[model samples]
Target: MRSRIVVGVSPSLAGLQALRYAVKVARERGGTVDAVRVWLFRPLWRDTTATFERRVHLAEAELLIPHAFDAAMGGPPTGVKIEPVVLEGLTVQSLVEHAGDDADLLVVGGDRRGSHLLGSGPVTRYSVRHARCPIVVVPPPALAQRQPVDALLRELDREIR
Candidate 1:
């Protein structure tokens, strides 16, 4: 009986854009929003903070998710709730698997360059293929519209030379 869209968000700017868009869409559709960010673990990795990383991740998620929820609600709270979920596993697989059975939809931000080589690469591809739910693959910004400062500097250097 839940009527909310689940958005997979991260601390990255791309993920932020997706989260913002999810709120907007939810507001228009008279629904609630759930924000989730997942961190994946590579197998056989040795790290000093591995034991403590989970706790730290949970804390960060608690702080950032609520803030995003509040920001999305805009003011005075319209009962549109934002639930933040922090999970660890295969990035996209964990997220898609953990998604509510009756969720309204699933929203995820996609990289413009299509980072299919990352650890979560296959996970992302699979989730998109078999989510069995409504999915919004937010298109990335145009490269021309977001040229890097380094590119500008290079041009200047070339001109000077």
Candidate 2:
């Protein structure tokens, strides 16, 4: 059977990396890719009525999947089958449910905000533990890691001078 690769999508750099990786693998394996994004109703979104707010959040999720594809691959990859899934629920749970047991692989972006000691963020960690399929966590490019520290050091030096 052709591989089914499910990858989580977010606005993070690592997220784009994971998406790109998933597309490449799908292309090579003659598989399909499910680019999934999960949306939740946060208590902080009290500015609008519940129903309308939920609709808006859902719409955002829909738009996000395409946006991620556009940003990652200049639009969806040419040869591979791409399915964009937007689910409303907890992030990790939604991803795991959509990926399911039969998926050949589940891919996620590592949490760059996490401390070096902790490795990945909570969602990535939870998915690795709970997901039935094998998982790959794509880390942010090294440039992403260095840019922040370099800026911070430059700022510190300026202050010292």
Candidate 3:
């Protein structure tokens, strides 16, 4: 059972799915979920306008946590503890660094709609290859449901066998 789980969250549907999945796992495993949102702001020059834009971007990134949490788990679960973290850096790098040595699992969402390859976004792809802890990539709900229930069951049974 995972004791500490880290989840990367954004405003996308895939991010919401990852959050939802992380909450469920934490509830079942008696663990805490660390919801991390990474923001990147690159300014060509350091000026008042650039600083103002950075502030605005940071504010928006901070707001995304609560909104995504609410949309995903219907407002953070009362049964599990959630810690929201807002960090400034590249999404994949930030998440990987956050996972560090203590986290037992890192949860992220796959971009099923946009990716033509593995249906995974850049963050998910990078995390899978570089994360220190075990990673769980939750596919978008629509993509998960694309397969018929019977077919899914059969596949599960075969895996079990």
- Output the number of the lDDT-best candidate: 2
Off by over 4 Å in 3: 113-119, 143-161
How would the candidate models be sorted by TM-score, starting from the highest?
A: 2, 3, 1
Provide C-alpha RMSD values for all models, in order.
4.5, 3.0, 8.3
lDDT of 1 at 127: 63
Q: Please give the lDDT score at residue 131 for candidate 3.
A: 88
Q: Which residue ranges in model 1 land beyond 4 Å of their true spot? A: 41-50, 67-79, 114-124, 140-145, 159-161
Candidate 3 residue pairs in clash (backbone atoms < 3 Å):
none
Q: Which stretches of candidate 2 lie over 4 Å from their true place?
A: 43-48, 113-117, 147-161
**Considering every candidate listed, which one attains the maximal TM-score?**
2
lDDT of 1 by residue, 118-138 (tens): 533454566677676777765
TM-score of each: 0.71, 0.87, 0.82
Candidate 3: TM-score? 0.82
Regarding lDDT, does 1 or 2 come out ahead? 2
Local accuracy of candidate 2 as per-residue lDDT tens digits, 1-161? 89999999998889998999999999999999998999988765565587788898899989998898898878877999998888888997899988889999999988665434267677887887899989888887767766587788999999999
